[model samples]
Target: MQILTPFKTITVSLFVLFFLTACSNEEATEQTNNTPVAIESGDECHLCGMVIAEFPGPKGELFEGRKSHVRKFCSTRDLMSWYLQPENRPNTKEIYVHDMSRSDWNSPSDEHMINAREAWFVAGSSMKGAMGPTLASFAQKDAAEKFVTKHGGTVLEFKAITMEILNTGSAMNMGSMHH
Candidate 1:
Protein backbone atom coordinates (compact mmCIF):
# COMPACT_ATOMS: atom_id res chain seq x y z
CA MET A 1 0.00 0.00 0.00
CA GLN A 2 2.86 2.46 0.77
CA ILE A 3 4.50 1.80 -2.66
CA LEU A 4 1.10 2.17 -4.36
CA THR A 5 0.55 5.51 -2.65
CA PRO A 6 3.91 6.92 -3.89
CA PHE A 7 3.21 5.64 -7.42
CA LYS A 8 -0.21 7.33 -7.42
CA THR A 9 1.35 10.58 -6.15
CA ILE A 10 3.96 10.45 -8.92
CA THR A 11 1.29 9.79 -11.53
CA VAL A 12 -0.79 12.74 -10.34
CA SER A 13 2.26 15.02 -10.31
CA LEU A 14 3.11 14.07 -13.90
CA PHE A 15 -0.43 14.75 -15.01
CA VAL A 16 -0.48 18.17 -13.34
CA LEU A 17 2.91 19.03 -14.83
CA PHE A 18 1.76 18.01 -18.29
CA PHE A 19 -1.44 20.05 -17.96
CA LEU A 20 0.40 23.15 -16.82
CA THR A 21 2.90 22.88 -19.63
CA ALA A 22 0.14 22.57 -22.22
CA CYS A 23 -1.70 25.58 -20.84
CA SER A 24 1.46 27.68 -20.90
CA ASN A 25 2.18 26.61 -24.46
CA GLU A 26 -1.33 27.57 -25.52
CA GLU A 27 -1.01 31.01 -23.92
CA ALA A 28 2.31 31.59 -25.66
CA THR A 29 0.80 30.62 -29.00
CA GLU A 30 -2.16 32.97 -28.50
CA GLN A 31 0.16 35.87 -27.73
CA THR A 32 2.20 35.12 -30.83
CA ASN A 33 -0.92 35.04 -33.00
CA ASN A 34 -2.23 38.35 -31.70
CA THR A 35 1.02 40.32 -31.94
CA PRO A 36 1.40 42.56 -35.01
CA VAL A 37 4.28 42.08 -37.42
CA ALA A 38 6.53 44.96 -38.40
CA ILE A 39 7.02 45.90 -42.04
CA GLU A 40 10.60 46.43 -43.16
CA SER A 41 12.16 48.41 -45.97
CA GLY A 42 12.65 46.55 -49.29
CA ASP A 43 9.62 44.37 -48.54
CA GLU A 44 7.94 44.04 -51.95
CA CYS A 45 4.20 44.17 -52.39
CA HIS A 46 2.77 40.72 -52.70
CA LEU A 47 0.70 41.73 -55.71
CA CYS A 48 2.70 44.53 -57.39
CA GLY A 49 6.38 43.89 -56.59
CA MET A 50 6.77 47.54 -55.60
CA VAL A 51 8.90 48.27 -52.52
CA ILE A 52 6.39 49.08 -49.80
CA ALA A 53 8.50 51.87 -48.29
CA GLU A 54 8.30 53.98 -51.44
CA PHE A 55 4.49 54.33 -51.22
CA PRO A 56 2.64 57.38 -49.92
CA GLY A 57 -0.78 56.03 -48.98
CA PRO A 58 -2.36 53.12 -47.19
CA LYS A 59 -0.38 49.87 -47.05
CA GLY A 60 -1.60 46.38 -46.10
CA GLU A 61 -0.48 43.07 -44.73
CA LEU A 62 -2.05 39.64 -44.39
CA PHE A 63 -0.88 37.04 -41.91
CA GLU A 64 -1.78 33.36 -42.21
CA GLY A 65 -1.33 30.03 -40.42
CA ARG A 66 0.66 29.08 -37.32
CA LYS A 67 3.81 30.00 -39.17
CA SER A 68 2.47 33.57 -39.48
CA HIS A 69 3.16 33.75 -43.18
CA VAL A 70 2.84 37.39 -44.30
CA ARG A 71 1.83 39.07 -47.53
CA LYS A 72 2.64 42.78 -47.63
CA PHE A 73 1.18 45.24 -50.12
CA CYS A 74 2.14 48.76 -51.10
CA SER A 75 -1.51 49.76 -51.36
CA THR A 76 -4.77 48.82 -49.68
CA ARG A 77 -6.31 48.32 -53.15
CA ASP A 78 -3.84 45.61 -53.94
CA LEU A 79 -4.48 43.93 -50.63
CA MET A 80 -8.21 43.93 -51.24
CA SER A 81 -7.64 42.67 -54.76
CA TRP A 82 -5.51 39.86 -53.40
CA TYR A 83 -8.08 39.10 -50.69
CA LEU A 84 -11.05 39.01 -53.06
CA GLN A 85 -9.51 36.15 -54.96
CA PRO A 86 -10.97 32.88 -53.61
CA GLU A 87 -7.63 31.14 -53.38
CA ASN A 88 -5.97 33.75 -51.14
CA ARG A 89 -8.82 34.43 -48.71
CA PRO A 90 -9.17 31.04 -47.06
CA ASN A 91 -6.00 30.87 -45.00
CA THR A 92 -5.82 34.52 -43.99
CA LYS A 93 -5.59 34.86 -40.22
CA GLU A 94 -5.32 38.62 -39.87
CA ILE A 95 -5.26 41.72 -42.06
CA TYR A 96 -3.64 45.10 -41.36
CA VAL A 97 -3.92 48.48 -43.04
CA HIS A 98 -2.08 51.76 -42.59
CA ASP A 99 -4.19 54.24 -40.65
CA MET A 100 -3.94 57.21 -42.94
CA SER A 101 -5.02 59.52 -40.16
CA ARG A 102 -1.86 58.60 -38.29
CA SER A 103 0.41 58.83 -41.32
CA ASP A 104 2.14 61.78 -42.89
CA TRP A 105 0.94 62.17 -46.46
CA ASN A 106 4.24 63.73 -47.48
CA SER A 107 6.20 60.79 -46.00
CA PRO A 108 4.10 57.71 -45.43
CA SER A 109 5.33 55.17 -42.91
CA ASP A 110 4.38 51.64 -41.89
CA GLU A 111 4.26 52.58 -38.20
CA HIS A 112 0.68 53.63 -38.83
CA MET A 113 -0.57 50.13 -39.60
CA ILE A 114 -3.71 49.07 -37.74
CA ASN A 115 -6.03 46.12 -37.73
CA ALA A 116 -7.83 46.32 -41.08
CA ARG A 117 -10.90 44.55 -39.68
CA GLU A 118 -11.47 47.29 -37.11
CA ALA A 119 -10.62 50.24 -39.34
CA TRP A 120 -12.87 52.66 -41.20
CA PHE A 121 -11.94 53.13 -44.85
CA VAL A 122 -12.58 56.13 -47.10
CA ALA A 123 -12.93 55.27 -50.78
CA GLY A 124 -13.03 57.50 -53.85
CA SER A 125 -10.59 59.86 -52.18
CA SER A 126 -8.49 62.28 -54.21
CA MET A 127 -5.30 60.79 -52.80
CA LYS A 128 -3.28 58.36 -54.92
CA GLY A 129 -1.49 55.40 -53.43
CA ALA A 130 1.31 53.18 -54.62
CA MET A 131 -1.10 51.80 -57.18
CA GLY A 132 -4.04 54.00 -58.12
CA PRO A 133 -6.93 55.08 -55.88
CA THR A 134 -6.10 55.05 -52.21
CA LEU A 135 -8.31 53.34 -49.66
CA ALA A 136 -7.56 55.53 -46.71
CA SER A 137 -8.13 53.89 -43.32
CA PHE A 138 -8.78 55.46 -39.95
CA ALA A 139 -9.26 54.09 -36.47
CA GLN A 140 -12.15 56.50 -35.87
CA LYS A 141 -15.20 57.48 -37.91
CA ASP A 142 -14.63 61.18 -37.17
CA ALA A 143 -11.22 60.98 -38.76
CA ALA A 144 -12.68 59.30 -41.82
CA GLU A 145 -15.28 62.02 -42.10
CA LYS A 146 -12.58 64.67 -41.89
CA PHE A 147 -10.68 62.92 -44.66
CA VAL A 148 -13.90 62.89 -46.73
CA THR A 149 -14.30 66.60 -46.22
CA LYS A 150 -10.75 67.27 -47.31
CA HIS A 151 -10.27 64.66 -50.05
CA GLY A 152 -13.84 63.92 -51.30
CA GLY A 153 -14.55 60.31 -50.47
CA THR A 154 -17.18 58.05 -48.96
CA VAL A 155 -16.58 56.56 -45.57
CA LEU A 156 -17.03 52.78 -45.35
CA GLU A 157 -16.62 50.27 -42.60
CA PHE A 158 -14.38 47.30 -43.12
CA LYS A 159 -17.17 44.78 -43.65
CA ALA A 160 -19.05 47.22 -45.86
CA ILE A 161 -16.20 47.44 -48.39
CA THR A 162 -16.85 45.57 -51.64
CA MET A 163 -14.86 44.61 -54.70
CA GLU A 164 -17.06 46.72 -56.97
CA ILE A 165 -16.43 49.81 -54.85
CA LEU A 166 -12.69 49.23 -54.94
CA ASN A 167 -12.75 48.63 -58.69
CA THR A 168 -14.81 51.74 -59.38
CA GLY A 169 -12.50 53.89 -57.26
CA SER A 170 -9.46 52.43 -58.95
CA ALA A 171 -10.98 53.02 -62.40
CA MET A 172 -11.83 56.61 -61.50
CA ASN A 173 -8.30 57.27 -60.27
CA MET A 174 -6.89 55.69 -63.39
CA GLY A 175 -9.09 57.91 -65.54
CA SER A 176 -7.97 61.01 -63.70
CA MET A 177 -4.35 59.94 -63.16
CA HIS A 178 -3.90 62.12 -60.11
CA HIS A 179 -0.32 60.96 -59.69
Candidate 2:
Protein backbone atom coordinates (compact mmCIF):
# COMPACT_ATOMS: atom_id res chain seq x y z
CA MET A 1 0.00 0.00 0.00
CA GLN A 2 1.22 3.52 -0.78
CA ILE A 3 0.45 6.55 1.29
CA LEU A 4 0.70 10.12 -0.07
CA THR A 5 3.26 12.34 1.71
CA PRO A 6 2.22 15.88 2.77
CA PHE A 7 4.08 17.43 -0.16
CA LYS A 8 2.56 14.98 -2.66
CA THR A 9 -0.99 15.61 -1.36
CA ILE A 10 -0.53 19.37 -1.55
CA THR A 11 0.86 19.17 -5.10
CA VAL A 12 -1.97 16.91 -6.23
CA SER A 13 -4.58 19.19 -4.69
CA LEU A 14 -3.06 22.23 -6.40
CA PHE A 15 -3.07 20.41 -9.76
CA VAL A 16 -6.77 19.56 -9.35
CA LEU A 17 -7.60 23.14 -8.41
CA PHE A 18 -5.73 24.48 -11.43
CA PHE A 19 -7.45 22.04 -13.74
CA LEU A 20 -10.90 22.99 -12.42
CA THR A 21 -10.17 26.70 -12.83
CA ALA A 22 -8.99 26.17 -16.39
CA CYS A 23 -12.19 24.29 -17.25
CA SER A 24 -14.33 27.05 -15.71
CA ASN A 25 -12.49 29.73 -17.69
CA GLU A 26 -12.95 27.76 -20.89
CA GLU A 27 -16.71 27.52 -20.37
CA ALA A 28 -16.92 31.27 -19.69
CA THR A 29 -15.03 31.99 -22.91
CA GLU A 30 -17.37 29.76 -24.92
CA GLN A 31 -20.47 31.52 -23.55
CA THR A 32 -19.10 34.96 -24.27
CA ASN A 33 -18.07 33.83 -27.78
CA ASN A 34 -21.71 33.00 -28.47
CA THR A 35 -22.60 36.63 -27.74
CA PRO A 36 -22.11 39.56 -30.13
CA VAL A 37 -18.67 39.83 -31.67
CA ALA A 38 -16.84 43.09 -32.21
CA ILE A 39 -16.64 44.44 -35.73
CA GLU A 40 -13.11 44.36 -37.04
CA SER A 41 -11.44 47.19 -38.94
CA GLY A 42 -12.36 45.73 -42.34
CA ASP A 43 -15.49 43.77 -41.51
CA GLU A 44 -18.01 44.08 -44.33
CA CYS A 45 -21.77 44.25 -44.07
CA HIS A 46 -23.32 40.87 -44.79
CA LEU A 47 -26.11 42.49 -46.80
CA CYS A 48 -24.30 45.36 -48.55
CA GLY A 49 -20.61 44.33 -48.72
CA MET A 50 -19.75 47.85 -47.53
CA VAL A 51 -17.06 48.16 -44.85
CA ILE A 52 -18.86 48.14 -41.50
CA ALA A 53 -16.31 50.22 -39.62
CA GLU A 54 -16.53 53.08 -42.09
CA PHE A 55 -20.25 53.45 -41.43
CA PRO A 56 -21.49 55.97 -38.86
CA GLY A 57 -24.40 54.44 -36.98
CA PRO A 58 -25.55 51.55 -34.86
CA LYS A 59 -24.37 48.21 -36.28
CA GLY A 60 -25.97 44.76 -36.12
CA GLU A 61 -24.97 41.11 -35.82
CA LEU A 62 -27.13 38.09 -36.53
CA PHE A 63 -26.35 34.58 -35.44
CA GLU A 64 -27.90 31.62 -37.18
CA GLY A 65 -28.35 28.54 -35.04
CA ARG A 66 -27.24 26.12 -37.71
CA LYS A 67 -24.40 28.24 -39.05
CA SER A 68 -21.08 29.04 -37.39
CA HIS A 69 -20.64 32.47 -38.98
CA VAL A 70 -22.27 35.64 -37.67
CA ARG A 71 -23.88 37.94 -40.23
CA LYS A 72 -22.69 41.49 -39.69
CA PHE A 73 -24.52 44.58 -40.88
CA CYS A 74 -23.29 48.14 -41.30
CA SER A 75 -26.56 49.65 -40.14
CA THR A 76 -29.61 48.58 -38.14
CA ARG A 77 -31.70 49.41 -41.20
CA ASP A 78 -29.84 46.91 -43.29
CA LEU A 79 -30.09 44.29 -40.56
CA MET A 80 -33.86 44.69 -40.42
CA SER A 81 -33.99 44.71 -44.20
CA TRP A 82 -32.39 41.30 -44.24
CA TYR A 83 -34.17 39.95 -41.17
CA LEU A 84 -37.62 41.01 -42.31
CA GLN A 85 -37.36 38.64 -45.23
CA PRO A 86 -39.19 35.35 -44.63
CA GLU A 87 -36.28 33.14 -45.65
CA ASN A 88 -33.91 34.74 -43.14
CA ARG A 89 -36.26 34.62 -40.14
CA PRO A 90 -35.97 30.93 -39.38
CA ASN A 91 -33.00 29.50 -37.51
CA THR A 92 -31.92 32.91 -36.23
CA LYS A 93 -30.31 32.29 -32.87
CA GLU A 94 -29.73 35.88 -31.80
CA ILE A 95 -29.78 39.42 -33.12
CA TYR A 96 -27.79 42.33 -31.66
CA VAL A 97 -27.85 46.04 -32.38
CA HIS A 98 -26.07 48.99 -30.85
CA ASP A 99 -28.15 50.91 -28.27
CA MET A 100 -28.16 54.33 -29.88
CA SER A 101 -28.97 56.03 -26.57
CA ARG A 102 -25.74 54.67 -25.12
CA SER A 103 -23.54 54.85 -28.21
CA ASP A 104 -22.20 57.62 -30.36
CA TRP A 105 -24.01 58.12 -33.66
CA ASN A 106 -20.79 58.59 -35.58
CA SER A 107 -18.98 55.58 -34.10
CA PRO A 108 -21.18 53.09 -32.31
CA SER A 109 -19.39 50.84 -29.88
CA ASP A 110 -20.06 47.13 -29.50
CA GLU A 111 -20.12 47.61 -25.72
CA HIS A 112 -23.60 49.09 -26.03
CA MET A 113 -25.12 46.27 -28.07
CA ILE A 114 -28.68 45.14 -27.20
CA ASN A 115 -31.25 42.69 -28.45
CA ALA A 116 -32.94 44.01 -31.61
CA ARG A 117 -36.37 42.53 -30.90
CA GLU A 118 -36.66 44.30 -27.56
CA ALA A 119 -35.39 47.68 -28.69
CA TRP A 120 -37.33 50.78 -29.69
CA PHE A 121 -36.54 52.23 -33.08
CA VAL A 122 -36.55 55.78 -34.37
CA ALA A 123 -36.89 55.88 -38.13
CA GLY A 124 -36.16 58.88 -40.35
CA SER A 125 -34.07 60.56 -37.70
CA SER A 126 -31.88 63.44 -38.78
CA MET A 127 -28.98 61.17 -37.83
CA LYS A 128 -27.51 59.11 -40.66
CA GLY A 129 -26.21 55.56 -40.52
CA ALA A 130 -24.11 53.47 -42.88
CA MET A 131 -26.78 54.14 -45.41
CA GLY A 132 -27.98 57.72 -45.91
CA PRO A 133 -31.10 56.93 -43.86
CA THR A 134 -31.19 54.44 -40.98
CA LEU A 135 -33.14 53.43 -37.90
CA ALA A 136 -31.74 54.64 -34.59
CA SER A 137 -32.14 51.85 -32.04
CA PHE A 138 -32.74 52.57 -28.37
CA ALA A 139 -33.09 50.28 -25.38
CA GLN A 140 -35.78 52.39 -23.72
CA LYS A 141 -38.99 53.90 -25.09
CA ASP A 142 -38.44 57.21 -23.33
CA ALA A 143 -35.04 57.52 -24.96
CA ALA A 144 -36.60 56.82 -28.32
CA GLU A 145 -39.23 59.51 -27.66
CA LYS A 146 -36.57 62.00 -26.59
CA PHE A 147 -34.71 61.21 -29.78
CA VAL A 148 -37.90 61.87 -31.76
CA THR A 149 -38.24 65.24 -30.05
CA LYS A 150 -34.69 66.16 -30.96
CA HIS A 151 -34.25 64.40 -34.33
CA GLY A 152 -37.75 64.52 -35.78
CA GLY A 153 -38.89 60.95 -36.29
CA THR A 154 -41.37 58.44 -34.88
CA VAL A 155 -40.87 55.98 -32.03
CA LEU A 156 -41.77 52.47 -33.06
CA GLU A 157 -41.57 49.08 -31.47
CA PHE A 158 -39.64 46.36 -33.25
CA LYS A 159 -42.75 44.75 -34.74
CA ALA A 160 -44.31 48.10 -35.67
CA ILE A 161 -41.45 48.66 -38.10
CA THR A 162 -42.49 47.43 -41.50
CA MET A 163 -40.97 47.01 -44.93
CA GLU A 164 -42.94 50.03 -46.08
CA ILE A 165 -41.40 52.18 -43.38
CA LEU A 166 -37.91 51.12 -44.36
CA ASN A 167 -38.62 51.65 -48.01
CA THR A 168 -40.30 55.02 -47.62
CA GLY A 169 -37.94 56.31 -44.91
CA SER A 170 -40.89 57.64 -42.92
CA ALA A 171 -42.28 56.11 -39.74
CA MET A 172 -44.94 58.84 -39.58
CA ASN A 173 -46.67 57.12 -42.44
CA MET A 174 -47.02 53.91 -40.41
CA GLY A 175 -50.07 55.29 -38.49
CA SER A 176 -49.07 53.49 -35.25
CA MET A 177 -46.41 55.87 -33.95
CA HIS A 178 -45.37 56.68 -30.36
CA HIS A 179 -44.50 60.31 -31.07
Highest lDDT: give the candidate number: 2
TM-score of 2: 0.75
lDDT (0-100) at residue 3 of candidate 2?
100
lDDT of 1 by residue, 16-61 (tens): 9999999889868755654456778879999989898887887889
Clashing pairs in 2: none
Q: Which portions of model 1 show Cα errors greater than 4 Å? A: 1-32, 177-179
Per-candidate total of colliding backbone pairs: 0, 0
- Residue 85, candidate 2: Cα error in Å is 0.8
Alpha-carbon runs more than 4 Å astray in model 2? 1-33, 170-179
lDDT of 2 at 159: 89
lDDT of 2 by residue, 1-179 (tens): 99999999999999999999998887665554357889999999999999999979889999875433699999998999998898888857688999988998889989999988899999888887887678999999999999999999889999898888898874443444554
Estimated TM-score per prediction? 0.78, 0.75
